[model samples]
Target: MENKLIVSSSPHVRSNQDTSYIMKQVVIATFVTMVGMLLKAYIPALGDALGLFIPLIVVNCLILARAESFASKNTPIKSAVDGIGMGLGFTLALTALGVVREILGNGTLFGMGLFGASYQPALLFILPPGAFLSLGFLLAGFNKLKNKKA
Candidate 1:
């Protein structure tokens, strides 16, 4: 009577959690924290410039959309590749826009004058409306190129 073995009516249950899946989540979290810390520490100016946007990168729509639509269903390596490709595409697009905006608005590329002392920058390009015009033109150019390729 002292030793009794009793079994419940519930079925056996097992968890689907695995080492790799848990490790991947931990690594991603650690990486994002480290990036935010490093940005705050080493690049204060850029951190200030970016403000909340830098910290919000993890929850950005582009990242969230890709993670849900693809990363969750794909292998880690494939997901990483997709992330890298998307990051590069984003970087390139921003660089192109910046180059155009800076040259037209300030007559400079990264604070170095490209058009010499006599150059007169278009003040309109430096204003808020100029940003919209620049983006629209860039999108149009990219679309034209894409269409030509097809």
Candidate 2:
């Protein structure tokens, strides 16, 4: 006769994987991408090199914590997909915020002044609080869209 073991949670079921493993993968992926971006910025001397990596590192740490707490037990494919989704989402949000701030603060997109000399730029849009305010409203907008779909 073959012997078998019963797996359960609180007297029910259990699995081989756990949260830590998933989190490690997420951290590795995030680090890989951030490092790539850093190298790109450093080599070409493009954009705000220091600021770019700082935000990436900050967001990566936040994602790492979340993945450890919630995503580690899942399968590799699922975890990868989730990580990609989150990365893309973060990129989109940041890009949108950057675009708004750049256009408003510099009166330009990609450093070209659209408003010419007549427009006085709003300096506040480029400040730290601007990023937070933009993100807050973006989150609210996303929530509204989600609610509408449901």
Candidate 3:
């Protein structure tokens, strides 16, 4: 097997490394980022602010998707870069989503009250159902822009 020349499907170049090996490397590289998120989660000033969403980025679909789609076929450095971009993108999107949900559900932004105490929060936005609905809408909007750009 070591002497064999393995072929990959069209357009993508290949290496002898298996999927598991590439995935492991990608995961290891991204682990550094996951730790930073955990650290932020423990930090007082920011923990309660956005910590809840930080750690979850480790398993974010964006990162995993990039790892499987790009890392498995690319060089280590490129894979690492892809992972970094995906990681940052994932975190940023989540942060924005959290902000939107927080503002709409609690009438607050960055823990600071918005629209005053008189403002009533939309209780649904804070709930799981609303979260999924919000995510769906966001994805739809993103897809629209992406298709238009393409």
Candidate 4:
């Protein structure tokens, strides 16, 4: 029964939980983080809107569309693995961009001032173009790596 459950046509399983489930999970997580941001905004020590929540939602939607369109029909286990991989990929990509931007734009990592006070920050790294350029290149790199492995 287990073997049969794992085998089928090109897509090995069918279920009600498709890309929508993944998207819903991601949206929920994002909303939770956004609420944290809102709380920080109200605090005197952290009173800035990072603008991350909106982009996170957009990225989550894109991921949902891709997963639903490509991975939904696969076996449940496979689909779950794929979802985890995609989530990790998204997180790593985002973290890399944030690290680069923070180091260049603020001369610090976690506000510790790694580069010292003499360092002149590149303010553009925190701007919209920085996110686009970083994400675009990271995506291209991921595609290249995936194709090479394939």
Candidate 5:
């Protein structure tokens, strides 16, 4: 009788420290930078409206929070997709808030009047505190619906 031993040829350890992750990071960073530049160059009106806020996106806490928590734990591709989803979520939230404020405060949607000329727009809804009130109501509505479903 003879004794024999065999070993399989495969990686025994898994690691995140790899060229693929590094390249993905680089690609995502470059794409974000390019998008910023394009927004500034092509959307002059928006650039003017937002002014320095555009540049402030680099230091935006929403982005930083996701990067620090989600991106750090997830794979590179997943992190990138999550970043996009977060952005869309943010956009939808802001747009909803803006629409609510506009309709209540100005009686207009995208500058088109929805109410009769005799209707009075609520000035209080246009002020800074109005943002807080609108957001609170929106959140409350969402919570009510969520609880109902649950």
Candidate 6:
């Protein structure tokens, strides 16, 4: 007697959503996030610090990925909610990351010194390498917590 076995990759599912619809959902979500940010922090100094990067958040990878992967497959309301969540997640992560790095590299956060004078800042943390290191650590932490909850 002979037995047959099959091996295959994950199956694909189809959805009725289209690109234009997904783009609209992403726009809606981005607008909401922007409005919230504007209301919460109206300081021009923050604007100056973020500058062009603030506008570029619309095209951020996190937003686009959520659009193509989550928004495209879900209803408009659901897509918008997902987009908002993802956008806020990015915002908080970057903010926290910058704060941590600033404290380590400059001995200050938001213009307030955490360490007294003569405390040598970890100059390396402010550099590109430090960005990478901080991001990696943050992602690892998020992953660990997410997996634990699941």
Q: List, residue by residue over 77-119, the lDDT tens digit for candidate 2.
A: 8888888888787788779988978887788998687998999
Stretches of candidate 2 exceeding 4 Å from the true structure: 1-56, 144-150
What is candidate 2's CA lDDT for residue 129? 86
lDDT of 4 at 111: 69
Give TM per candidate: 0.53, 0.56, 0.54, 0.55, 0.60, 0.56
lDDT of 4 by residue, 2-116 (tens): 2223332225133433543454555555665666566676763443454455446656666776677557468878888898999898788779988878887788998699877
* Candidate 1 runs further than 4 Å off: 1-59
Any runs in candidate 6 off by more than 4 Å, and if so which? 1-59, 143-150
lDDT of each: 0.69, 0.66, 0.68, 0.67, 0.70, 0.69
* Superposed model 3: Cα runs more than 4 Å off: 1-62, 144-150
Instruction: Name model 4 segments beyond 4 Å from true.
Output: 1-52, 136-150
RMSD of each: 13.8, 11.0, 10.0, 10.5, 15.2, 13.7
Q: In candidate 4, residue 143 scores what lDDT? A: 97
Q: Could you tell me how far off, in angstroms, the CA of residue 49 lies in candidate 3 after the best superposition?
A: 21
Query: Which candidate model has the greater lDDT, 2 or 5?
Result: 5
Q: List the residue pairs that clash in candidate 2.
A: 7-13, 8-12, 8-13, 9-13
Q: Model 2 misses residue 22 by how many Å?
A: 19
Cα error, candidate 3, residue 74 (Å)? 0.9
The candidate scoring highest on TM-score is 5
